[model samples]
Target chain A: MNLFKLAWKNITHNPLSLLLNMVLLTLGIGLISFILSVNTQLKDKFEKNLADIDLVIGAKGSPLQLILSSMYHIDAPTGNISIDEAKPFLREGHPLIKRSVPLSMGDSYKGYRIVGTDHSILELYDAKASEGRLWSNLLEVTIGSVVASNLDLGLGAKFQSSHGFNDDEDLEHEHGTFVVVGILEPTGSVIDQLILCNTESVWEVHDHHEEAESAEEEDHSHDDHEEHDHEHEHDHAGHEHSEYEHDNHDHRNDMSRSQLLEHGEKEITSILVQYTSKTNFQALSMPRNINENTDLQAASPAYEINRLYDMMGTGTRALQLIAVLIAIVSAISIFVSLLNSLKQRKYELSLMRVLGGKARTLLSLILLEGIIMSLLGFVLGILASQLSMAAMAGSLADRYNYEFSSWQWHGSEWYLLAASVGIGFQAAVLPALMAYNTDIHENLSDA
Target chain B: MLKTSEIRHSYKGTQRFTFPEIKCDESSSLMILGKSGVGKTTLLHILGGMFKPLSGDVSINGTSIYTLRGNNLDTFRGQNIGIVFQKPHFVQSLTAEENLMLAQKMAGNSVSTNTVHELLQQLNLDHKAKALSYKMSQGEQQRLSIARAIINKPGLILADEPTSALDDENCKKVVELLEDQSEQLKAALVIVTHDNRLKQYFKNHIELS
Candidate 1:
């Protein structure tokens, strides 16, 4: 009876053509929506984790890799930098640096990185303990919110750190058992996926591991020497070996925290430096100066992330172009289907005029049909995008340890809605005009 | 009540049509008979207010239909006149009942499902009310067409070759239905056709060309 009802009826009259048009439209809109959401979340996460840190100084390698490893925690470190060599930057009261948090990483638990860092790292991300308290002792650990939930590790939970980032039982360190002391509130940054402990814990775990290997080697060498030595010489070597074992035991058990850090060639993965004055000349020149003059490399996270985006933009642009092309094709399909239906329904349209319906009524009916189809397609496309994103969220989090919210609405989707309706209007104009200009006398006379 | 005066029309690159004057009072019926090419359809269109005459007036229910233009004329026609065409055209997607409701809605009348049901019952099409219009048999479609034409309760009903595609039994049945409905509404009825079998049925007749 109403124009909307009439329009709906007309479109539903040919179910196959309607379904085809709707499917094509849904695909186009869904792809565009999916891409937009992913792009937004990626940019959001990168910017949030960029934080107040001005530069990352690490062992020389790809500047982008240094930033990814140090700032985003999604890549392996370039290598470790000796703490003695990095001492000037890591100094507590250096004039150019407001704060420096040194990272010593080469350990993980169940694929989540265990970052051995100072408490300053929490202050850098504005993080606070949501449960218990921050790590103060050599073996006590504070977990990020995501780390705590993912590993189901609450306060007082103890687990041995794996030697590397992967979850390998053989590589699990036997020398150190880390007890979870605190869980940090979600900061919406890379910090949310890290486990923080004092830097000495990493050194202690690896130092014990190396000492064990060295003792095994010394015992093997003594056996070989015994096969070639006189009894008196072998007895003399046995006395020296026990003396060396006694010293090694003392070295392992008696070293204090300060002695451990200041001992021969201590190393850390990276130094995350925040400037006292961000816009000053020293802050601006620091990365280039370090890259050119020192053995270390300093990467600006902002600069490197921009380059990353530029690299990703090309693929995104290509996908957007393809989605647009699909949208155009869908519009054409709408036009073709409407025009074909108009041809078959010419007599019916003319008959409406004979039934005392206005010419504009017929015109609007056609327009309404197109608009209705496009709106339905748009709704379904949005739902499809959200559902697919939700389905992919688990794997994406497993890979990047970043949360991808499936149902976030973006402003651009409004523009997409308008564009969809515009496409529908454009497609229906010709058919609607044809309906408006129907010749009642000619059409009715023929029958 | 319907009347026309000196109605005429012409299409581009076609012959001009000069139509005879017509008048029919309330509850009366008139048959305008002519072969094809004589503009039998043209005269029906003018009387139905679908065609503007070259220079004439068509008045239904004492209002000059042609004098009203554009939407006013459309509204006037919808309120005062109902039309049934041969071959039983419909909004094919709608059911038989919905098509009847559409006529009432388009005519700017309140849609009364009761009236639609009663008309379908009178036309012997009540059983097919929910059936898609195009799915019905030819005779049933024709009866449904009559149901749509009178759903708005117009002052005048115009039939253009209404019985041309029907058989002898169906043709007689359709004309009688039209007559009976027109009498019930007390509306004037006008039938334009080339069929000679209708000659014995009409009380008043005009031949064109």
Candidate 2:
């Protein structure tokens, strides 16, 4: 007997129009919600992995590509730079530099990059071993949390490295087999998808291939050399044999830090630099100085990422505008349906007035119907968006090696709820006023 | 008792009407007869408290209804007077019984299922309690309309051409039902119609040319 029950009955009395309005509303709201969720997650991932690196110095190439390759590990490296040319920035305790971590890439295990770096990388990303211990030897390795779970690699698991960032059996490096010694905890950063080891391992694997190729050349031209050349070849083969035997006995016997640094001819892919004071004049001038005076290219990660966001913002803005337009269209649909029903219910409204019902009662009854329809559409729209996001999460993670969660609440959704209710109220106002002003004598007359 | 005095009305200051004074005592019936365009429906609207006369007063049970104004007038009219339209109309979404409950509720009275069931049984509509009001036969809809009007046990009942659309047999049956229900509540009854067939049923009559 209450207005709410009566409104509900009136809505249910005409099923086709109600269903039409609900479908349009659900589509419009769902699209808006889905876009908001994806935009939030993309911004979150990009900001989290920025990691406060002041500059990236690499071989001359695109500055954005340098940041993407060295920082996010999503693109190909520009090229390798000789360590001798990069030594001035890599030196310890330089006045202008706070810290620098050198990176040597060009290796992978099952599409997960094997990054060769120093212990400073672990501190840079605030990474800690969740199981076992961090790698302290040349051939040992530490795996990211995602790599461990996805490839099911645990402590003491052994795997050989491939020459590039793709899984190809032909490019497998048979001379090197890395043993996982630790698994890092998830940091929700780029580090969670990498396999980290010291710089010497990458050098050792490639150096062994070079020496083996030269030895085969010497065998084909044995007659051209003198007796001393034969002895020199035997001595080098014996030295390599002893090193191989020592690898199995004790991993700590591998090349020490000083010995690896003494080899000045080595090459590394990039160096990630942090400034002693970011606001200092020298730090601000450092990237430009390196780019102009030297052969190396220096790029600021924050600037590059901002450029990337600006490029992406246009597409998202267009999509958001389209979603809002659809929502407006849905409001118009609700208005038209309610207006039509009001026409059909003219006699019924007059009957209510004659039966001692106030004009305001009829007004509230129409308002209640509109609000109920909008609220139902709002709830269903949100559910549909979240469900679709969760369904797409698996493939997104596999493609980008980043996790996306749909359960997190966003503040914009509350605003969306308010907007939906406002639309409902706006649509109902005209029809409700019409019902309030119904002509009782004209409608109820026997003419 | 129901009474009116100096009842006069006009539409947009053009056509005008001056109705004769009317008075009906408890348990009595009065019929106002006129052809179309003679303001029979206008007089019914004024008597039912839906239209305010240009200059007139309608009093039911010693309370002047038109002078009450706004919601007070609406509440008074709902509690003291019942109206039956010429063409039977209802809130189409509600069932026959729910329509009765709604009338009682709108009149500031608690819904009494007992009274609703009793009225439905008396009007031979007990089997249609759950049926949608608009889906019923024309005769059944007419009976349901009467049930809604008197659900609050008003002191005055007004009918506007209540039987003009019915066959001779159904018209006779409807007139008997209205008289029987009005006598049971001991309310003053007024019927306005162009159908001369009802002239023989009421001794008290007024005609407008």
Q: What tens-digit string does per-residue lDDT give for candidate 2 at B10-128?
A: 88999989999999999999999999999998999889888888898988898888788677877888888898888788888899999999898889899899999999998899999
Weakest ten-residue segment in model 2 chain A by summed lDDT: A253-262
Which ranges of candidate 1 are over 4 A from the true structure? A207-261
Off by over 4 Å in 2: A107-111, A160-176, A202-260, B112-118
Specify the highest-TM-score model's number.
1
DockQ for each candidate?
0.73, 0.65
Across all candidates, what is each one's fraction of true contacts kept? 0.72, 0.67
* C-alpha lDDT values of all predictions: 0.85, 0.86
Residue B15 displacement (Å), model 1:
1.2
> Residue A415 deviation, candidate 1, in Å?
2.0
